[model samples]
Target: MNIKELQQYVSRFCDEKGFEGIPLETRVMYLISEIGELTDDLLEIKGATTEKQEVIKRNIGHEMFDVTWNIFDLANKLDIDLEAAFKEKMNINENREWKT
Candidate 1:
């Protein structure tokens, strides 16, 4: 699904899960927690020496979804179009020169 569809899906899921009452600050905190989980997964993968790499990667994906879900939900609550904002930000980045 595209961003909008995913946003809708997540919104519905959040609603059904009784997450609709979460405040913006709570969402931000949850997103931050998910980021920490993702970071831990990444660090494990970077230092991995076993066959659990795939498991860690899967965990990382889950963490990423958690972050994105909160982002979409919060954006919806704030009436912000994340897709547009993302595209606009990318346009600016695409036009800028790298500082290599």
Candidate 2:
């Protein structure tokens, strides 16, 4: 689903999960923790045996989803349009000079 729809879904979930009253800063900390988890999985993947690699890969994917879920929830709580912001940032990046 698109970000807007996913944000709405997360909003409904927050209500059900009682996360609607959670502080913005706390939500941000949760997001940071998810990022750390993702990093840990990446490190594990680097040294994983072939069979273990699949499990680590799935863990990494799940961690990444958690990161995005937190991001969407935070943006919804703050009334930010992430899709719009991402597009605007990409447009700005498209015009920047870069070293070869």
- lDDT score of model 2? 0.93
Tens digits of per-residue lDDT for model 1 on 1-100? 8988888888899889998898999989998988898898898897776678888888888999988988899898898888888899999999799878
**Residue range with the least summed lDDT across 10 consecutive positions in model 1:** 46-55
State TM-scores per candidate: 0.89, 0.91
| Model 2 C-alpha lDDT per residue in residues 1-100, reported as the tens digit of each score | 9877888999999999999999999999999999999999998898779999999999999999999999999898889998899899999999999899
Error in Å for residue 31 of model 1:
0.5
Error of 2 at 51 (Å): 1.3
> How many clashes (backbone atoms < 3 Å, residues ≥3 apart in a chain or on different chains) does model 1 have?
0
The TM-score that candidate 2 achieves is 0.91
Pairs that collide, model 2: none
Candidate 1 accuracy as TM-score: 0.89
Model 2 regions more than 4 Å off:
none
